[model samples]
Target: MASTSSFDIVSDFDRQEMVNTVDQALREIKSRYDLKDTKSTLELQENAILVNTDSEFALEAIHTILRTKAAKRNLSQKIFDYGKVESASGSRLRQEITLKQGISQDLAKKISKLVRDEFKKVQASIQGDVVRVSSKSKDDLQNVMQRLKQEDFPLALQFTNYR
Candidate 1:
């Protein structure tokens, strides 16, 4: 009898990388000519990033900076679920960007269904925020991973614990 090969699929990000990106963005905002004098603020919370600026253009600029910094750190842009910008007191605009760290139940189910439908030799089961996939043949597991890579999901997926 052969043991099964298994791996876990997770949607996660590096918190330290995110913090470093935010710090870089803040530095850039302070040094930039247009943003230097503005009362703009950028902060990273436990689960969200907060941005405060004076105008729509400034808000966009801040977002662009954050995205660029994140990309530089090899972080996926999909990890950020940006909220709608709202007007704050005194003509200020505020936006909250939530960091995605785990697979949602809906997405996990979708992934499991896709794996089951496409790869008959593999078994996929949702375990909380992760999806575990197992197969008798390692090649089948590799094939499943390849197929999943070809499909574009809303959030970024990472494969781990392959054994």
Candidate 2:
């Protein structure tokens, strides 16, 4: 019997990188001419980011800066699931941007189905927020990874624990 090869697919981001990006964004907000007097604020919570600004224009500027910083840190913008802007006290606007750290059950099922349908020799099983793909041939596993990369998914994925 041939030994099976497998890998796990996961969607996660580095917390330190996120912290660095937020710090950079804060610095830019303080230094930028247009933003210096706006008193805009950005706070990183356990699983979300709180952005508060006085106006819609400032909010947009903050978002642009945040995106730029995140990209510079090699972080995917897809992780940011922004909520609706709400009015706060003193006419301020607040927006909560949730961080996506895991794959949804629906997406995991879709991925499993795609793998089972496309590669007869490969088997994919959902394990919570991750999908484990196993096959007797390493080449088949590589092919599965390539196919998954080619397909556009709303969230960013990473492959790990290959054995």
Q: Top lDDT: which candidate number? A: 2
Write the residue-wise lDDT of candidate 1 on 43-155 in tens digits: 89999999999999888899899999999999999999999999999989999999988999999999999999988989999999999999999999999999999999999
By summed lDDT, the worst window of 10 consecutive residues in model 1 runs over 34-43
Candidate 1 Cα misplacement greater than 4 A, ranges: none
Please report how far candidate 2 places residue 38 from its true position, in Å.
0.8
lDDT of 2 at 11: 98
Pairs that collide in candidate 2 are none
